[model samples]
Target chain A: MFLPMVLNSLNPLLKETFVNELLKCNERTKDYGLVLTPEGAESIIEARNNILNSLGRVDMGIEVALGLIENFYTSTFINEENYVSVLNEFQEIFYYMKNETEDMISDDKLICIIKDYYENLCGGSLELLKSCLEEFIHDFRRKAHTAEAGLGGEE
Target chain B: MEQRDNSGQTLAVQSKINSTNLKKSQYTIALLNESFRVGLMSREEINNIQIQIMQILKELIARYTKGESSSVCAYTAESILNSILYCIDAYALGCDSPEEAICHLKSLQISKLYERGVKSVSRWLEEARELYKKVRKNKLNVGLESYDHTINEDIPLYFTNCGIVFDAHNGAASIDYQLTFDDMSINGILYMKNYLEHLWIENAFCKYFNSEDIEKLLSDFGRTIGMDYKIELINIFELVFNNAVFAILAGIPEGLRISQYHFDLLSGKLKALDDSEIDKYICQTVEKLVKNMNICELNILDYIYRYKTVFTQRVIRLVRIDSLRGIILTEKEEIKKGYTILFENGKEMKIEDFNLFIKKLMKLKNTEDKIALIKSGIESLNDFVDLLASDCLFGKEFEALFNELGDMELAILAKMALYEEIRSDFRGLRSVISEKKESRVEWHICFVEFLKKSGIDRIESIERLLGEIDYTEISFY
Candidate 1:
């Protein structure tokens, strides 16, 4: 009973859903060997659990994780040999983003910004994607603490 | 009532148990209980009352399970049960006949429980005991208002009774004793309120002493005990008294005993008690008490009289302008001229006109507004003091605001604020900056290099801005 509960309880479901979404991310994405292995899937599940436990239950945990994975999977940076290492990096980035953004940005919105930056601004570098996320979080937090009345999306 | 459904079968509408239904059911039980005791109620009446009460309680419990009244502590299944018991008792005691008792019980308001003697120390605590028993038996996860919710870990802490006896009986052998509850529980607060309220009710303290008399006694005690002559012993006593009452309410068992923390704060060793959980609890509880209590006979001010310092200290701790140690003033005292006032940013300004400076500084509330004033060229020591006390400037914002101000001292101050945020090692940087006291220009250069060594990325840009002395800009002093 506990086994099924843990397996089904948001974390594993999120990991499964994300990996399935990554498989269908794009046509060229499939040729790049960007698929997550069982071990890779397990690590995502562990990281998801850790994030959820620390941040309490967010309204969009699965969507956020899936969004990050799908965005990463579809990127031009996802080479055949770098898939495993990239997946590991994605886990850390996703975890960091969740906390740094303070769960204010919805999964869909955060994904939109990342996809925009990855395709247009940063020219498909994951390192630049991480930098953009850090800058966004810093500015987002600063405005949140100071400009309570002025910020539009927050309300 | 049956109604025909779309599928042509008769549907029976369920009788809902809402707030109105609950009140009506409570009234019915109360009436039945009264009649049953008076031997006017039939056996059927008793059975029906039992079934009705059970149904109402079941609905209340189900609502609790669904998280209703979860945020609020006033009403719960246990509390409602206790309310039913109290109503029954009040009806039984307040009236002679069953008919009269029914009328009396129906008129007894929840807020009037105090007047009805249903919320006295003995009655409320008896209900609490029963509630705790039920909680233990059922292993329910309900929050108890009487218990300290702040305690996360189960450490074995117990109550230590520190009883105080007042010997003010006109030189006669008269004594009044007060007991301490070393535990944090609502019962302790209620007990303290009960004791103090009883004193007011009986005018027990009046026969021997009054407020002024107590003040004189405290002063005598202070002198005999070698307490600081500057410290108002009467104010401390009143504060301690109110604090004791608050502690009881917050389920703090320690009562009103001065914790080592309070002593540390009083002695300038600790700058603020706001960080302390116990202090936070006391302030919150006292605020709640002040808002809720309605005493026509006894003014709360009379009890707390001229003791605003304790509350002020709880608001903002003013440390010494020179040594940066917290000055334990019950209220804000105007500083003398030539005293160097320090900000949290480690910048200090020597005041030329102390009284006027404080008067202006007290008018402002945030650092950003103060910085804005400085930006518009309001050159004064007052603006600097206000900036120090203001809350708006934090971490990166401090760096930005300092950049806009374009003062060398502020640049140094911004570096201090940034270093504080990153928890960077400042030992070597501090020694270098302290030694460069030859000229203001030399010290500024040394600090700029130190900022670069400390990994402040914007040092050169800040240094270039600092070179063009905007005398039109406000000085740090």
Candidate 2:
């Protein structure tokens, strides 16, 4: 609670530095021949809002979540043209997963799971990543259903 | 209470005075307790009100005892309680102050305060609470958004105890607003409150209806309920309320008709209610609902229009009669068998002559007939037009016959025959049929005007060709 207020008061200074640092990093990362750019910040903000609204959550793990987003996009095959849309779709998946798991799975764990799927099983396919997220939600729901049944409860 | 007259003579107070004829104040407190039980008075406020009333009696007694006043007024337990109720209602209706409300209540010419204040106001308040509870907490768990799918967002329905106040989050701008009830106008409060109860009633009615029927009904009313339309929530409530009341009073089994199939359905649902009370409640509720709509400046036209089918169907059910509009469709099926006309020469002509004449006109196979009719002059055409105006033609057949009359003079003559000519014996049927014929004539004239506008001026049998074109197909716009 205190952190957002403190960060909000310092947002103007932080935003200027943050944008400059992002651009500077983009410039250096070009040497490593990655097509990443600093155009996906809007997508991150939208994602943050969707998660916060749907889960009724504060910005506890939002920055780390955003950081995880930036890391995946920079290393993946997403270019400037499709990065915003791809990030938005990912945000939808993340929001849906959080609610489906009843927030039992932390944001860090979700991000880690997505990263592993993206690099290994999915091979950088957004479609495959979505299906993986759906499977995770289905599993979570099944387990919840089983638990309810065991407890003699109806949902 | 004991009092003294101006002459220093002791007087007996009415209301079972004991010993020296002092009136007892016991019934005053008893009335307050009864008011508390009926929910007109809160526990905290009851004692204070009882004391204040007793204080008024005491001051009057003291003035008379000192011989400052000539007379003291007698107040029974019933009369005192009536005044308290009047004050309570007036205050609840947003008086400037309780004192002002009480002062205003005293001036009203209330003959029977027992019926007006205690019984009527208590029932209204009770019904208001039940409706508010049903809308906000809905025991069925069925939401308002169930019937209105255009409400995309899941907004919670809110109600406060201040008398049938329903608050809604209007989808636009996410603003929460209450459809205000004019507390001073009892009908206005009841009108808004009954809407909430009607929502619950509709949910129950839906159980008897097939899913497809509900879909068709909703689609028919889609213009008002659809997303693009932003009807005020109160208007939506009115629409639902009107439909629900009609459904319960007389079930609508088909479009614009109340069939007996669903009457038992409504009766079954209302089986819990006392049979005698049901009819009384229906009359009173319907009367009040209609009265509120009539007296207030509120425009329920959109609501009435959206649910016109059910509204008209219920009215038709209650009156047990088909409207003139229904007769137009009935005429499409067959001709009136006994509709024969007597000429000036006392010769009766059967309707088949007119039918055959129209059929020949349609086939354009009777140039000689037209010549013969012309030779016979205006009298012959008048007879033909009179038969035509009897509304013996279907919409398509009417158009076809009128179009077959290639003369514009003949068409104008047909218009006159339908509107001006009258038959006294079949008065009701003639008026209805004449009105319908007038509408068909207007449509013919409109289509002819369209043809003239489109530079198709010299065509033969324009009405015939226009009749071939569907009503939806012909658009002057």
Candidate 3:
């Protein structure tokens, strides 16, 4: 249910695999999202422009600053209506996360919280999503580390 | 896929959907509805429905943002916004369970973009439409030849009913490279680089100006006028235009409608320097250029030739409107909201109907008020002559405190910003771009200010209706 509505009509078989892929993507997003300390988001955002020419992961360093989210707006892009709704949610979520960085939560718990959000708001689809999340986390971690090294060189 | 480990937080969301017979999942979205319904949902319930929709969107994003799908570079600002919406709509219409929803959203979204791309080329069509109207007014017929033929048969903005006509008809090109430096030489970047160079003086002035070829023209003009129009010897910069002149103009590929702002900036840059002050001026111009242009454009070793230009064909003509009113940052002719009013004829006419127009303009709540004001001003605008006729009133003493009607912002505020920056950074040169140019108006100001600044003679005869607004350095392009 937390899945963005833009991708709502899933074929029965592909649904089984897609859930896993999405979970993988989420993990990567999370890993990338938690690299920057809250204060570093601006610098990271500024760095995004520089990213045009190079493979350096300066933008990844920004998420490292944001850290993990317990209850944030869905990161899903969907139909116009849903897109707007989710954007509003993220606006609040990002603001709130920026305001409260000292507080931390476990990865599994965060995922569970996200699932709960989906269930209540739309409906529920948890297992397939979780299966794919680990891959996303791996990719995100790798990228974040690369960006961290880049930050070291700049200083 | 494994079960979600749920020893976390849990809450039971109350069914805000009060009516039992109505399917709660069938959320009524006001904007998305087929315009036929007159049904209304309470504000709170509407919000809940939207939140549910957002959750569906979140899931869709999860479904497709994998593989080489989201990696497409042709994506645009609108696309990013649209794709998110597309998936959500697919979700809303589907009866499939969560697993099946992902694939459907992904396939549908891509298909829509693919299908729409064929027709969504309305961007140029819209541009063509605007151009058609402008061309009709100006009575111009021009055509563009893009190398690629795909852009052909593309319904342009101008309409002949059978086919859309475009002012400039062309397509993108993929060309075979003719170079020694590999594929980098084949980049379609010359146009882009040229564009950036226009707005940012540092980027293009020297490149275009310092060329031996350009020097010949400048020297010739100088000899002809009995005064040097150095053109590019001095430093330069611009605001509102991209970092460089070329870069800024690049955004609007069509020829630009030149304004006082563009001229003012050019004058501030290429105006002649006195022989005695030449060295100081050179230092200042160089300093300003360094601070503003993209230093990366040229190799450091090519300093001598990087900016050198043999100025030729690209002839620029300028005329500046000087005033202390609402001319600052004026990208277009109409003055600021609080300062001046423009009529259909492109002239500022606020003095006669100032109070009533302003009071109504201030309370402008919707389209009707704005339209009414526009009509009233346009209908009998004999009181306000357009800037094209300013020549008629030249050499007159006018009592209008909000001087100059044409869109020029280089008056006081511009002087102030330039003064502050130059004094701190390029101070030794006496910070002159803001200084009055060689003009009869400056002669009058010099005569007046000389009397005021040092108890001498003033414009002793205060004649009726002679343009009293006197400022030195008014540009004549």
Which predicted model would earn the best TM-score?
A: 1
Tens-digit lDDT string for candidate 1 (B181-254): 11122223133333334323223212222344334333333322222122221222333354344334434443
Please state the error at residue B242 of candidate 3 in Å: 23
Candidate 2 regions with alpha-carbon error over 4 angstroms: A1-43, A46-89, A92-116, A131-155, B1-430, B433-477
Worst 10 residues of 3 chain B by lDDT: B310-319
DockQ of each: 0.01, 0.00, 0.02
The C-alpha stretches of model 3 lying farther than 4 A from their native spots are: A1-149, A152-155, B1-56, B63-83, B86-414, B417-477
lDDT tens readout by residue for model 2, B192-294: 3444444444333343334444433332232211111122232333333545454445534222222334544444444445545555656555554445434
Arrange candidates, best DockQ first: 3, 1, 2
Q: Each candidate's lDDT (Cα)?
A: 0.41, 0.40, 0.29
RMSD of 3: 26.8
- The sequence of per-residue lDDT tens digits that candidate 2 reaches over residues A16-127 is 4444444454554454453434455534554555544544432322344344545665555665566556656666666566556765566557767777787788887889
Task: Output the number of the lDDT-best candidate.
Answer: 1
Among incorrect, acceptable, medium and high, the docking class of model 1 is incorrect
Clashing pairs in 2: B1-B23, B403-B464
